[model samples]
Target chain A: MTSAPPATPVPAGVRATARIRATADGRGGTALPLLTGEGPLALRRTRGEGAEAGVMLVGAMSAPLGGDHLAVEADVGAGARLALATAAATLALPGRGGAPARYDVRLTLEGDAALRWLPEPLVSVRGSDLRVRTRAELAPGARLLLREEQVLGRAGEPGGLLRSRLTVTRAGRPLLDQELACGPGAPAGWDGPAGLAGHRSLGQLLVVDPAFEKAPAAAAVLGEFAAVTPLAGPAVLVTALAPDALRLRELLDAARRTYGW
Target chain B: MASSLAALLVLADGRFPAGGHAHSGGAEAACAAGRIHDAATLAEFCRGRLHTAGLVAAGLAAAAALGLDPAELDAAADARTPSPALRTAGRRLGRQLMRAARATWPAPELDALAAAFPRGAHQPVVLGLTARAAGLGPLDAAHVAAYESVGGPATATVRLLGLDPFEASGVLARLAPELDAVAAEAAAAARRARTEGTEALPAASSPLLEIAAEIHADWPVRLFAS
Candidate 1:
């Protein structure tokens, strides 16, 4: 994959929308963002309707596998009402890549806005080491819903080192966070027989709803081996585990079936 | 006027019903695997975690206490926490803290923030808000931060070490001075603009902790979430 010169940080006002919905090709990638960053992929929320808007990062060009950091400032407008959803990012990666590439997604929710994130699937290529970092905030009564997923390899293909770290916090506090560095022959956390029973691609979904958490329904929506937990009266936490990539997608579809319009 | 002592009493209560008991502070697994042993080693572990995850996370909560943008605080803490299990642990604790704090303090804004960040926020942020709701100042908020970040594991060590529970409580009590000192220093440092990154909260960093946490993630019979 060819790399573009570092991505120049544009001024906050009226930055053009960057929306690339790329898919994974056998050799490397397709339609990924062909660009460079002064340092890494950074998106700062200059301003927007607290709950009505959010910046989307689409990968049109897949760059060399290394460490990539994506920083974001997400503001969930206060008491904005309607349940906004954030799509869980779905990335397709090959395992053969040398070093692990780290991806960090940071969020800040203010006012009374709500957000829900759901993505397709995150596939790690053979021998490739991958890492992901995510941080999100939930302001007062701002409903935040999210699902994180990862696959060892593409359907029927080889998979390798796919390490990752995810941290989620509200009001600068920690609700859910973890770091994993796993490779072939290593036990994937929460995938052992006793953990989640060897699920390959898994997800940890966080839901903030003042009314009913309804964890049972959330798991059914994901359609995989998942555990759901209730927290803080206005919060819901779901841990979904799958045996492979396809199964993980099935679960995401299930979640949409249960909670989405 | 809600006294700081009242807030502390509620926040630090072992049976306050925040589900703090379900967690093993990574100490249980680490100890079971021989990663930590005895009080000296436990002290070492707590100190390391204080700077990395604890300080950084609690710092964000302190920002929230200062009325800094909650979103910024959440993002910074998110950037700091990298583990999925630990991430899950943070959100769970944060959620419960918000729930219990709301019951005691009952602020509309607190309820709103709790709803917005249900699963991903950390414990310090909740403490910051509850401290405010409980009529606590910056110093009191900082104390809550230090205790939530370290006290969980210190208590866990008591069970793991088979040490007297009273001694474990004493160890935590001894930390009061340190907690007070750090909270004071952090409050002093937080007197800055919202744009400035506040790194003085509470955090703990240890590669072994990371490795142990990762290993624990794969355990089917693991005791704690992190």
Candidate 2:
């Protein structure tokens, strides 16, 4: 089995697209029958460990400075399993001529499918404007575990503006619909005690599955920084904000491991 | 003419008793954190809320005022509010606001909505319908929503931080122009929402506010409900 992939930097303004799909193998298992993509996006597949199906490495050559567009789509067939991860953080540089960079992601999960998407943090440099939207559609009995983190600025610097929206639905019913805007002049009161209370880094992890509630140890593993909010449906959202990126990373990693992924 | 404009005043009034006094709109939590220690920062904080959640609320209210289906708007409200705690707070306030609106205007649609979500719909949904029952237009409803978005927080700060009442009032007055601009945009968006569906409404959200509201809800000792 190969180790984790290394970081690569892709140029700005290029649109990258990747698509992966799971298929039923003859041995009562699933395989990545459709794995292909283009542009700055790269995907590396490795053998699965434990009860996993496979692991895919998602990487880019350079930071999406400004005006860059990246689109990623993944599908898990019934009873399949896949874990998607990134090699390094993506920096949101200042917009070239005030055009906000864009990142869009879509995921589809079939019956009894499971996926884990743990992307690296996005560092928003000063004067940068970025827009990111993610949509997830899940069929009955499907499961998804995802995490997202953002740092307003580099160490000793103020952060840029980032507007992100995340929408998840299960069997055509809305499970979670969240929109977050941060950085300079954003609506959220980052300095407020009720808000970030002066935290510069924010992280969120979401778990969508019927089995989520059955596991009683999940909340205990979240620790102090992260707070888990279980919804009325089969979804739970855990959020945390920290004074620095390191703390946020530690908290989210702990949460990531809590799910046993 | 006097009564029509007075209706707007009555709904926008801070003392109208719509259960808004209990919510700092996340301001109490902000103040407790020392993010808003003075008048200047308080103004800035209110400005952020006005443009983001305020604008979104105004848009939803305007759509409701335009006579759109209350149930659809309620669902839209649910979609916009990602925080479970904030959603519960919004619904509670909505119920209180609904009781006040029904008593003040006595409209059948408002009665229908009250029956639909006995627990309560989102506050903006009820606020917009309440404006319609009061003979106000979409723009008027937007103004009420936009102003209250900040108004609740400003007043809450006066109590939480103990800032000068006069100074807080001044902060609101200073925000008049921006508030007007936001209300106008909300009204225009509501006009589009008529044909484009509720998706046309603004979804601007404050991550910190939503997160803080959730955290504050867990606090065993807090002054505000949200």
Number of the predicted model whose lDDT against the real structure is largest: 2
* Residue pairs whose backbone atoms clash in candidate 2: A8-A61, A9-A61, A9-A62, A10-A61, A10-A62, A152-A159, A194-B29, A194-B212
Q: Write the per-residue lDDT of candidate 2 for residues B1-226, one digit (tens) a residue.
A: 2238989999998888898998898788777766778898788788878877898899999999999888888877876776778889989999999989988999999999999999999999999999999999988999999999888888988898888999999999999998898899999999998998876778776666776676677788988898
What ranges in model 2 sit over 4 Å off? A1-12, A55-57, A95-98, A184-197, A212-226, A257-261, B1-3
Provide the lDDT at B100 for model 2: 90
Backbone clash tally (model 1)? 104
TM-score of 2: 0.88
TM-score of each: 0.47, 0.88
Model 2 chain B is weakest, by summed lDDT over 10 consecutive residues, at: B205-214
User: Per-residue lDDT for B1-226 in model 1, tens only?
Assistant: 4456865777767788877877766677657755457665566555545434454555666677777666656655554454445656777888888878888889976887877886636776777777777777666676666676567778788877786777666666766665666666566656553545543333333334433454566677855666
* Clash count of each predicted structure: 104, 8
